[model samples]
Target: MTDTPSPLTYAPPALAAREDLLAAVRFDAAGLVACIAQQHDTGEVLMMAWMNREAVAETLATGRVCYYSRSRKGLWRKGETSGQLQHLVELRLDCDGDTLLALVDQLGVACHTGRRNCFYRAIRDDALTTIADPLMDPAALYGDAHKGHSHG
Candidate 1:
């Protein structure tokens, strides 16, 4: 990925007024909003996840990225079990206030598959292809806890 900063980079809103700011977001019927994480410096799109109100507040308060796990039905602190972590640089709301963009400083691999990001497959030459390989083994990342299991 290029190191160049795109036009998306800007001064984030102050956290002092976070509650009021968060009130403006339009969460869906499930009380969740789609969040897209991107590398703050390189502008590499990392992953897309869901975040609820509590997740959003926690992220802003702690400066650590958090998401809502629909399957587990709880707050998922990104990379809590694994060494990989995402430090929030900024969080932006989309124009419709239904989507969120998270500018983060990612540590290690961002995917449970041990890849740098989740978008590893691509449509290439009229066929689906694996564009990126795993940087580390999935077994190494999650150990026995995730053995024979796959992320949904």
Candidate 2:
């Protein structure tokens, strides 16, 4: 009933030119794009972060995932302090090119709260419930220097 090509037999459209990867993305007014990091193998969503042009470029060049931190107002290289790094496996752009999905190999906990991922809380029975427990103590991960500040 539809003319759409089957996913099994679908082929990617040819690019008009070999354009720069950054040029294909549409950033926000703050020159930032939303990026979702997911477990490469298990398909578990790790965390969400913002990426600027510089972050994207650096990630591609170094094969390391980098994010722009609005709180720090600088580039936040994942696992720089917590030892929980996210290695880049594949970077995918949405159809609108406004969001990016980074398939990654997470080294350790992906949350500042010491959980496996950032999505620990879920709404249950009309109340916010804590689902996942911290894998490691926050102090152990960041030490006293980063006491109050969030890791993400």
Q: Each prediction's Cα lDDT score? A: 0.84, 0.81
Q: Candidate 2 lDDT (Cα, whole model)?
A: 0.81
When summed lDDT is taken over every stretch of 10 residues in candidate 2, the lowest stretch is 10-19
Per-residue lDDT value at 131 in model 1: 95
How do the residues 1-152 of candidate 1 rate in per-residue lDDT, one tens digit apiece?
A: 53433323434347767987599889999999999999988889999999999999998887789999887788989988887889888788889999999989899999888899999999999999999999999888889966653332
Which lDDT tens digits does candidate 2 get at residues 29-98? 9999999999877889999999999998777666678999888889999988889888877677899999
What is the lDDT for 101 in model 2? 90
In candidate 1, residue 114 scores what lDDT? 87
Q: Give the least accurate 10-residue stretch of model 1, judged by summed lDDT.
A: 2-11
Which candidate number would show the highest lDDT if scored against the true structure? 1
Clashing pairs in 2: none
Cand. 1 Cα-lDDT: 0.84
Clashes of 1: 0
